[model samples]
Target chain A: MRFIDARCQLGRRCVIRENEPVTKAEILELMDRCRIERAVAYHAIAKEGDVKAGNMELLKDTEGDSRFLRQWVALPHTFGEFMSVEELLKGMKENSVSSIRMFPKTHGYSLKPYALGKFMDAMAEHKIPVFMTYNELASEDALYAMLTDYPKVNFIISDVSYREERKLFPILEHCPNFHIGTGNYVVHGGVKTMCEYFGAERMIFDTGLPTGSAAAAVSLICFAEISEEEKTLIASGNLERMLSEVEL
Target chain B: MRFFDASCRLGRPAAFGEGMPWQTDEILEIMARCHIDGALAYHIVAREGETQDGNELLLREIAQIPQLQPQWCALPATYDEFLHADALRDAMKENGVRTLRIAPKSFAHSARPYAMKELMGFAAECRVPVFFDYGEAPCDELYEICHDYPDVSFVITNTAYALNRWLGPVLDACGNLYLGTGNYVPHRGLETFCKYYAADRLVFNTNLPTGSATAAVSLVCFADISKEEKELIAHGNIERLLGEVRL
Candidate 1:
C-alpha cells in the first residue's frame, strides 16, 4: 500500500554519533524503499537548540523537494528567540509550513496549558497541527491537561507505544483532535482494535524514519488485521486530510 | 522469508494484559500468519509456577508440534530444585530439549558466573544454546559467563534499545555470543552490526504474541545489507546453531 509518513527527521541527532547528517536524497531513497509517497520531517538539530536555525535549515534542505513537507519547532514564549505567536503563524503561512513540532523538555518549558496558552491558541486558530514525540510529552497527566485545555488544537502523538493505550484511552475518549502515528504502536491486534473503537481517521502512518526502522513500521501496518480502507486511511489519507485542512 | 523464532512464549502472561490462553495451536496460527516456520518457546507456567511442572507442561504442549521447540528453565546448581549438570543433560536428551533459559531477576537467583557454572559447562559440552532475555541477568554478568565458558553458545534475547555500548564489547570478545533480534532496532543498526561483527552472530526472533513478529522479520528483510547477510540473520545462523544441538 502507498504510504505517507507523518513523522520523520533529518540532520544530526544530538545523542548519536556526530556529523552523521542524512541527506534529502537518502531520505527519499528510504521513502522509496519503504513505499512511502511523502514524508513530513523536522530537523533533528531543532530538538537540541536554536530551533530557528534548525527550522531554517530544514526549509533550505527541502527547498526543491515537494515530497518533503516542512515542519518547524515551537519554542516557549519566554525564550523570546522567535517571533510572537501572530508573526510566527504569518511566517508559517507564507512559507507553506502546515505543521509544527514541540520539544518541551529540551526547550525548558512546562507543557501545562497555561504555559503554552498563546502558542496553542495560535495553532488552534490557524488550524495548524502540532506534533509531539516522546521528547516532548513524558507524562499522561501533562498530555491530558494540554489536550483538555486546547480542545481546538490538532495534536499528533507520534512514536507512541501500543502499551500506552491504558493511559491514552481516557484522554482519547475526551479529545477529538488527537491522532496517533503508527511508528512504534506495534502491539498485537492493536491497530484493528483501535480502528474499531476510535475509527480509522484517528490513526496515521509513520516510520519514525532515520531513527527507527521504516520497513518494520510498514510491515506492521501491512500485516495488521484492519480492512484495506482502514489501512489506506492510516497509510496516507488521514495525513493528507490533516495537511490539506491546514489554513494558511 | 521463513523464520525460526528464537524468542516466543506459550501460556498466559503473569502481570500484563488479559489472561488470554496462549496455547500451542494459537502460537502456530500466529506464526503461520507472520510467515514464521517454527519457534523456541517456554511456558509462562515455567516462569510463574514450579519449574518441573512448567517443563512437563511445555513438553506436553509441544508433543505433537515438532516446530514448537520446548525450552526448559534452569535453576542454580546449589538448590538442586532442578536437575544439575549430568542429570539435566540426560533429562534434556530424553525430553527433546535443545535449549534452556533462566530468569534470575524474576526468580530471585544470583547472576554470578559461578552460580550456574555446571549448567553452562554441560550446555557448552553438549553444544546447546542457553538463552537470556532482558531483566534475566545483567549484561556484565552475562559477559562474565560467556567469557568464562567460551565453548558454550550463549544467546541474548529480547535486547533493549541503546544497548550498543554494552553489547559491542561483549560480542566482540565472545565468539560464542549470539543476539536475538526481537527488539533491537536502531537507525541502520542491523547494517552497522553486520559491518562490525559477523552476520552469523545475529539471529531472527519474534518475541511473538507479546511483541510484533512482523516487525522483527521486516527489520532484517529490509536491512541495507547483501542478500546473503539477510539470509544468515533471517534463519540460516540460528538454524546452524540449532543443528549443533545433540538432542
Candidate 2:
C-alpha cells in the first residue's frame, strides 16, 4: 500500500544522537526503505529554534524534492511576532504548502480561541489540517476544548503513546475533526480498536521521521487486523483526501 | 523471520483499554497472526502482588500452551515471601523455565546489592537472563543493577522513544545490559543501536497483550540492517540467551 507520512520534520535541530538520521538524504533514504511515497514535512528549526527562519529552512531544504509535502509551523500573530492570518494563507498558496503544524507547549502559546481564533478560522475556511504531537497540549481536556472551539479545523495529534486510550476515546467520540496519527499508537490491537470504534477515516498515517520510526509506523498499518479498505484509508487515503481539500 | 518475544504478560491487567487482547487465547491468536513463534511471559498476578501464587499461576496458564513459556516474577525473598535460591532454582529447572522478571519499584524494594544480591547471584550462576520494565530500574538504578550483577544478562523492556540519552550511557558502560525492542520507536533506532552496539544485544520482544506485536516485528524486519543482523535480533540472540541457561 502507498503510504504518505503526515508528520515529519526536515532540517537539522539540536540534540541529535550518534547514528540518528539527521540530514535530508538520510531521512529520504529511510522513507524510501519504508515505501513512503511522500511525507508532510515541517522544519526542525521551526520547532526548536525560530518559527519564521525554520519555515523558510524547510522550503529551502525540501526544494525540488517531490518526496516531501511542505508544512509550515504556525505561531499566534500576537505582538506582530509572526505573520498575520491573511499573509500566512497567501504565503501557503504561493508556496504550495498544504498543512500547518503547531508546537503550543514548546513555542509557549495558548490554544484557547482567544489566542488562535483568527488563525484557526482561516484554517477552517481553507480546510487546512493542523498537526501537533500529543505532548503539545496541556491535557486531553485542553485538546477537547481546542477541537470544540474550532470544530471545522482538522487536527491530527501524533506520538500519542499507548497509555491514553481511556482519555482519548471520549474526545474521539465527541470531536469529529480530531484525527490520530498512527505512528506510535502502540497499544495492542489499538489500530483495530480505533477503526472499530471511530472508523479508519479518523487515522492519518505518519512516521515522525528523523526521530520517529518509519518502519514501525508503516508496519502498524500494514499488519493491522482491519480490512484492506480500512488499511488503504489510513495508509494514504485519508491524508490524500485531507490535503486535497486544502483551498490554499 | 521467526520471532520469539522476550517480553510478554499473561493474565488480565488491573486496568485495560476497551477490546484489549488480554486473555490467553487472544494473546496466542495475536502472536500467531504476527508470526511470533514463542514468548517468555510473566503473569500480572505475580507482578501486582502475589509473587509465589502468581509465578505458579503463570505455569498453570501456559502449561498446555507450548507457544507460551513461563517467566516468573521474582522478589527479594524477605520474610520468606518468595522462594530461596535453591528452591527457586529447583522449581525453575523442574518447569523448564529459563528466565526471571523483577519489579523493584512495584515490589517496593531497593535494587541495590543489599536487597538483590542473593537473587542476582543465582541468576549469574545459572546464566539465566533477568527481565524488567525500564520503569522498575529507571536511570541510575538501571546502571547500578547492571553493574551490581555484571554476570546476569539484563533485558530492559517496554521502553518508549524518550530514553536514548539515558539508555545510551548505560549500554556503553555495561556489557550485560540488553535491550528489548518492543516499543523502542526512535527513528532509525535499531540501525543506530546496531551501529554502536552489535545486533546481539537487541532481543526481539512484543511486550504483547499491552505492546503491539505487529510494530515490534516490523521494527526488526524492516530495520535498515543486514540479513544476518536481522536474524540475530529476530530469534538467534534470544535463542542463544535462553540456550545458555544451565537451569
lDDT of 1 by residue, B1-247 (tens): 6778987888866665563336667778878887888888898888788888898988988888888888898888675688878888889889888899888887787756567677777887889998888557654566666778889888888887656645665675679889888899877888888887868899888886677777898898889999999888888988898899975
Put down candidate 2 lDDT per residue, A1-248, tens digits, no spaces: 89999998887779987788988889988988999999999998999998999989988998898889999999877545589899999999988899999997777556655457778999999999999999998889989989999999999999999999999999999999999999889999999999999999999999888888899999999899999999999999999999999997
lDDT per model, in order?
0.81, 0.90
lDDT of 1: 0.81
Report RMSD (Å) for each prediction in the order shown. 19.5, 19.7
User: Measured by C-alpha RMSD in angstroms, how accurate is candidate 1?
Assistant: 19.5
Give the alpha carbon lDDT tens digit for every residue of B30-90 in model 2: 9999999999999999998688899889999999999988999999989998899999999
Interface RMSD of each: 17.1, 16.3
For model 2 the TM-score comes to: 0.53
